[model samples]
Target chain A: MTVILNQSFTGVSIGAVLLLIALGLTLTFGQMGVINMAHGEFIMAGAYTTYVLQKPIGDAGVSLLLALPVAFLVAGSMGALLEWLLIRRLYTRPLDTLLVTWGVSLMLQQLARDIFGAPNVQTTAPGLLTGSVSVAGVNLATSRLFILGFALLCVAGLAAILRTTPLGRRIRAVVQNRDLAEVSGIATGRVDRTTFFIGSGLAGMAGVALTLIGPIGPTTGTNYIVDAFLVVVVGGIGRLRGAVITAFVLGLLQSVLEYSTTVSVAKVVVLVGIVAFLQWRPQGLYTVRTRSLV
Target chain B: MTTTSTPPTAAPATEPPAGPPETPFLGRFLGRFRTPAAFLLGAVLLVGVAPLVLSDFRLGLLAKYLCYGIVAVGVSLAWGRGGLLVLGQGVFFGLGGYAMAMHLKLADAAATGETLPDFMLLYGTEGGLPWWWQPFANPAFALAMTVVLPMAVAALLGALVFRRRVKGAYFAILSQALAAALAIWLVGQQATTGGTNGLTGFQGFFGYDLNDPINQRMVYVVIAVALLLLMAAARQLFVSRYGELLIAVRDSEERVRFLGYNPANVKLVAYVVAAGMAGLAGALFVPAVGIISPALIGIVPSIGFVIGAAVGGRASLVGAVLGAIAVAWAQSTLSDAWPAGWTYLQGLLFVVAVGFLPGGLASLRTVLRRRRTSSDRVGATKGVTT
Candidate 1:
């Protein structure tokens, strides 16, 4: 029972990270109708940003806090720039966007490889997060708990922004009906730019958060992009809450299965299950309204 | 619809003028060499003669291209006409490749008088094949499974997604994620699936020696013939009622649905057919290349398959085959010349292709034809005046 609990906890912790990475992807893919294949690269940008700032801050806690905004800004600006330069042309052409972003992703990966030298960067846990706490006879990593809390906070904060802010309203308007919103003078283009910024910024934040539990590498983004995409798809397009829930479900399933059998077997079982589930519910667990006839 | 309504009201658009009395035979002969026909002929001839002209090393390269071409044909059907953007053909390819590899490995073990392969021993497995792998030991069963498994998966996935009306980027991402997950799982399972190194070091296929020059040339011939058969099949489908329906569904699914056709069924047929082709390609790839690995079927290669199809003109059957072979050939040559620089060259090609030439190499003929016809008209008009 204790072993199960520990595995479940570990699963939830990993799930939290998956949720963070996927949140931005879901928004871009689901709401904005842009398949940003380079979203993972944005997360890498954030991780590198955090890594670069670790020394200047003098402590892990301060460094993380400082890194968050810095990472977001760096990634966000890049996202906006990408939107202005490339994504804007691919508005209604999703497949073209997939190809173009894939190209951008490769370019970014190569750039990172050149700069970072293909080695995993060491990220130190803060003094407050370094230790472990015993809960129900299971030793739980404190950093994981902090990450869970931080992820929840981010979800709440993002939800609040979407629900309350004027920019959020414009984004929602643009998402629902681009032509109608444009006719009403909503500046759909500007909304696209800002939304991309926020989405990419979130990815960057995810990268920084991932550093607490894992090593940062140029290709680290590639490792999580697939899982994050799965979470978004399984949860449902344009559904933020669905993404979070699905991430936890998959993460927990993976952890428990890995503990019982082997990691590889667990992955295959989970994937097969997910593929079957998708076959049954193609729109996923939650459905969202969109302009697409499909 | 609005564009369709517009007629040629502005002028007769550069009319053809009188020329010297034309020889019907010459005109007919020249017409036979027109772009599309010439391109088709060139491709067929190249694949046919390549084995004869090239060394053993080059034949191996051509064999790999043929595998890529097979996958591209499927991509053309799914993404080009069906508008499905299936980024997970790699999963099917891997499935077929691995199945064939398992059978070959098991066959080798039996011949060597070992109960299990060397890798199994290294991994601390008892000298016996796994239960799931047992079926593959039968050559006929392995071949059947190689094609059937991927098609079944595609059918199931298509039925679910198409029925629910999940098309476009959402479907693409889902399929891509599936490929990624499968690759990861395969890489992790060193005992069952050959880990990252994948299944290599094969001695023979069935009883025939793989090292024989005649056999290698025969493999190339088989690949070329298979490619031709696939193209013919694709062409037949393209000109059929089903093909028209598929295009109709792609252009306007609601209208097709209103016309009493199930768009889902239409899309599903193409999807499943594409999967089968990819599986067949994979099965052939295992013996031709002597390996099947996670690296070959990962996210990158999946995208690579699509890029080739897209750049070759996804809607064109010949384009898909040629484009795939061309890109694969380029990659091999470039990588051999400058491994570090090949990726950058690929990126450049992609950007140029997407940004400037949306229809790819296939459309170049259309452009040239237009220019030639216009020039012919100009020459005829000048001749008449003179």
Candidate 2:
């Protein structure tokens, strides 16, 4: 029973990271209909930002805290720039966006490798997040618990922003009806840029969280990209809450499966399951109701 | 209802170029075969003329490029013409390549009268050959399996995916996932698959000594011939009614469906055919390249399979072939010059092509002509495209 609870905790920790990554994807891909294959690279950039800052800041706790906004700013600005230069022109061409972003991903990966010396780098977790705490016969790493709390905080913060902020309202308006939003005097393009910024900033923060759990590498983001994409897809297009729920569901399922089978086999099983799920429910767990006919 | 008034304008727009033209029977027949004839000339030059001028080593490299050209031809049919954007031709290529490699390995073991192949001895039990690999001991069976395996898998996958109406980015991602899964599977099954090292160290192919330069040249000839034949077949398919239906499906799936045609089945056929061609290319690639590994079946290489088609012109058959050869040649030469920089260049090329040159190199002529007649810019931009 304790082991099961521990595994579930681990799953939730993984799910928290997944939620951060998928939130960005859900907004850019699910809501805006742009396939940003380079999103993973943005995460890589965030981790690298933390890695570079570790030297100047010196103290792990302070540096770790400082990395979050710096990483977000770096990745978010890059995302915004990419949206302006490439994605802006390819709005009507979704598949073309996919290819172009894939190209961008390759270039970014190569850039990371060249700059980072083609090896993984370790990032030290703050002393506050180093130990473990036991609850109900289950011993949980303090870092994992911190990640869970941070993820929840992010979720709540994002929800509040979407609910209260003018920019968020504009984003929602544009997603629902672009032409209508434009006519209603909302700056649709600015909303797109802001959405991309926040989405990519969340991914950068996920990368920061990732460094606490494991080593950072140029290709580290890619290892999680497929799962993140699946989370967004299984959750449903344009549904943020659905993304959060599905990310945890998938994370737990994978963790439980890994206990029973080899990790590779577990992955294959999860992928197959997602493929089957897609076959059964092509619109995913949730879908926006659009009145226009094809 | 919105399309009710479109036919009158669309019909005149599309019909005038061929509506009233008449030509002599011989001229019409020759015109129909013009592209194929030029392709034949190109093949002859590649196969016959190159051998005399280039050294054996250069010829072998060209042969490998030709193998890529074969796969690119399939990519052209699927992505260029059918608008499927199949991002996982590597799965079919790997399947076919492995099938042939398994047979060659088994053949090598049989030649030594051993019960199990060398890698199996280390990882797998020493009892006997595995039940699955037993069929591949025969040369003909292996060759047949190469074509059949990809065709069967592609047909099944295409049927399932298309039936679910999974397409666009969804289809692309799903296909990429399958390739990743396949690569991981291959890597994990080290005992049976030779793992990451992949199936290599072949001495002979169907009793021909690989050490001899003559046999190597023979392999190149075989590849050239196979490419020519596949190109001819693709050309025929492109000019057929099926091809027209494919274009209709691409341009407007709803209209095609309303016309009482099943777009899914049409796409399935094209996909299966493309898979079969890729498998054949992979089969030849094994002997020519002397190796097949999980590295070639991953997402990167899978993307590489179609990148050539995208750069050359996905819609043009000859363009795909030329693009594949040119890209492969560039990779080899560029990497030789600057080992680490080639990938960056390739990635930049891909981005530039997809972003600014959607029609690829084949459309250069039309683009230039449009530049000459600036008034046609709007019409050119509004041309039917994916």
Highest TM-score: give the candidate number. 2
Candidate 1's DockQ is 0.29
DockQ values per model: 0.29, 0.42
Taking all chains together, the TM-score of candidate 2 against the true structure is 0.93
Clash count in backbone of candidate 2: 1
Sorted into a CAPRI-style docking class, model 1 comes out as: acceptable
lDDT of 2 at A162: 77
* Model 1: how far residue B315 lies from native, Å: 1.2
Q: List lDDT for all candidates, in order.
A: 0.80, 0.82
Instruction: Report the lDDT tens digits of candidate 2 across residue range A98-204.
Output: 78888888888989988897889998888989999989999889998888888888888887887798877887777666778889998778888989998898889
lDDT of 1: 0.80
* TM-score of chain B as predicted in candidate 2: 0.89
Off by over 4 Å in 1: A56-58, A279-281, A290-293, B1-40, B364-386
Q: Ten-residue segment with the worst summed lDDT in candidate 1 chain B?
A: B1-10
TM-score of only chain B in every candidate structure: 0.85, 0.89
